[model samples]
Target chain A: MNITAKAHEDLILVTVGEDRIDAACAIQFKERMRELTQAPSSRVILDLSTVAFLDSSGLGAVVAVMKLLGPDRKLELSGLTPTVAKVFHLTRMDTVFTIHPSLPDGLQKAG
Target chain B: MELVFDSNLDAVRGGLADLLDSGPLCAMEADARGTAEIVLAEVFNNVVEHAYATRQGRIKVCLKNHPDGVLVTVIDSGSPFPQQQLPQGLLPEINAWDDLPEGGFGWYLIRSQVRHLSYQREGKHNRLTFCLPY
Candidate 1:
């Protein structure tokens, strides 16, 4: 799995490069996100533009990251492919996190 | 035949995709193909992670294409899971950020994606079967 993190003034944008994020990479993905968001940032935007598939474990990882960020920090999801978006909708996670159409949009909203 | 993967999830997915891409099973439509791939990846990930605990183990994937659809059976001698007894309901009220719960959504995904789902434990072996209509 390839994960790239770009830090902005108030937000960090992380792009997931893997086509699928399941049990195999869920732990790694969560740890990487945690490391990226450790410093105090206004928000975190997860760019899933390349992710084609996600399972329960992957969802759990994202949820865990949100909890780590807590109420003080905002977490947004952007560029969810059709399949990945379906999972979020099915689990009703679309209601939990702020979903944006793109990273720029998410950052703009957060800012 | 029993297949072994060295803790590589993509390799297992690729192997399954190759198997399903050939023979009579290749006739599956695009939607069915997508659902089948998702189901396969979910189950295979379960076997590799929960069952084997990321350790080395053997996964037996049996595929059969019938007139109705395609049947895929996964058998592993790893940790046993009581998937049959899981409660069935749509918890739309429960938000994702709420209190964490265990062993609910994975079964939901499996039930929702596959046409049929059944689990059996024959002694040490845990067998899970899913069918997809072509």
Candidate 2:
């Protein structure tokens, strides 16, 4: 899995360039998200445009990041592909976090 | 038997999809695409996670179109997951309104999807095989 981080304004955007963020990459993904959230950002947008699939491990990693962010910070999701989005929806996580259709939408909403 | 992936999850799915697309297994009455993908993801994720904990390891996956259904086997030298000790019972009722929990659902999905799932540690390698029947 390849993850690229870019800081924009008070938001840190982490774009994941992996097909699946399952158990294999969950720990690393969690670690990176943790580091990003610690830097004082109002919002963290997880760009999943390139991610095609996610399983329990991948979902756990996202949840872990959400927990680390606590209630003070905002963690939003964007660009969830149909398959990936289905997993979130099936787990009922769609209602738990703010999910946007695109990066700009997520950023605009966060702003 | 068809060889489609070289251990990577993306490649594994691609291989599985391609094989299913070209083989007789594709015509099966049951919808195993989603189930197969989920099961493969869980097993492959385990390889990418625990087996290659510090160093990178390679995994070999093979899908065989059987007379009854399909047999998928993942072979890796990484850490092994104990199939016998798997948690058994009904799926936990998920409250969609609340936050989602991480990790346990993979096991739940794997158990629910496949008919006979087994994991065996052979020497230093682990082989996880699951049979999905039509």
Candidate 3:
């Protein structure tokens, strides 16, 4: 239920505060993101460093956030736990967004 | 061990996490535990969202530890699986950013990581089983 948002230069970083993005919070997660992005940015990143678990509903929430950004803006990802990373890889969503091992790495890649 | 869980969304997930926390089955090889957690969460959430819908119902979860893996049997007295036939080897094509699919990845993820995944409807109860065989 805790979704944090910040701005890093050109990119706005939204961090997931919960250990899981499952059904328990997916809908709320999406709703929160809609509110988080009320002040829009050209580039966005979802920081999943604290997220230890993810399910399809969680994954869908991420996808929905990505779509909300539209084509002009991009949603990059940083700090994906193995299980979460596996979900991205298995679903071939790793190709959909730029993913990095850490926020620094994501920043470096964004440059 | 068996648990008759509340049909609430949070209850299904929290109940499974509690069950897994009460055992070493989640400590299996590599990502075995995470895989089991996600699969179980998906199925249980599906029951609450689809089967139970707006109505409250009973979901019986039986956790049997086997030599090779853990066998999870979830019995629910709600509507049967809506999909007439579960899709086989469904790997959605996400070639581009716009190609990204928002939903429908739950069963695919479950089937890909699990073994002996089976489902049945006995009268009013929908029985689904799968193994976290590491």
In terms of TM-score, the best-performing candidate is: 3
True contacts kept of each: 0.18, 0.49, 0.79
Model 3, runs deviating above 4 Å: A105-111, B24-30, B83-89
> Model 2 over residues B39-72: C-alpha lDDT tens digits?
6676665566566666666777677776656887
Where does candidate 1 clash, by residue pair? none
What local lDDT score does residue B15 receive in model 3, on the 0 to 100 scale?
85
Candidates 1 and 2: which is better by lDDT?
1
What's the best-to-worst order under DockQ? 3, 1, 2
Interface RMSD, Å, model 2: 3.7
**DockQ of every candidate:** 0.32, 0.29, 0.74
- Candidate 3 root-mean-square deviation in Å: 2.9
Candidate 3 lDDT over A1-111, as tens digits, reads 788787766778788788888878888999998888777688887889889888888898899888888889988888999889988888888888888788864454342
i-RMS values of the candidates, in order? 2.8, 3.7, 1.2
**Deviation (Å) of B17 in candidate 1:** 4.6
- Cα miss at B132, model 2 (Å)? 4.5
Q: Which candidate model has the greater DockQ, 1 or 2?
A: 1
Candidate achieving higher TM-score, 2 or 3: 3
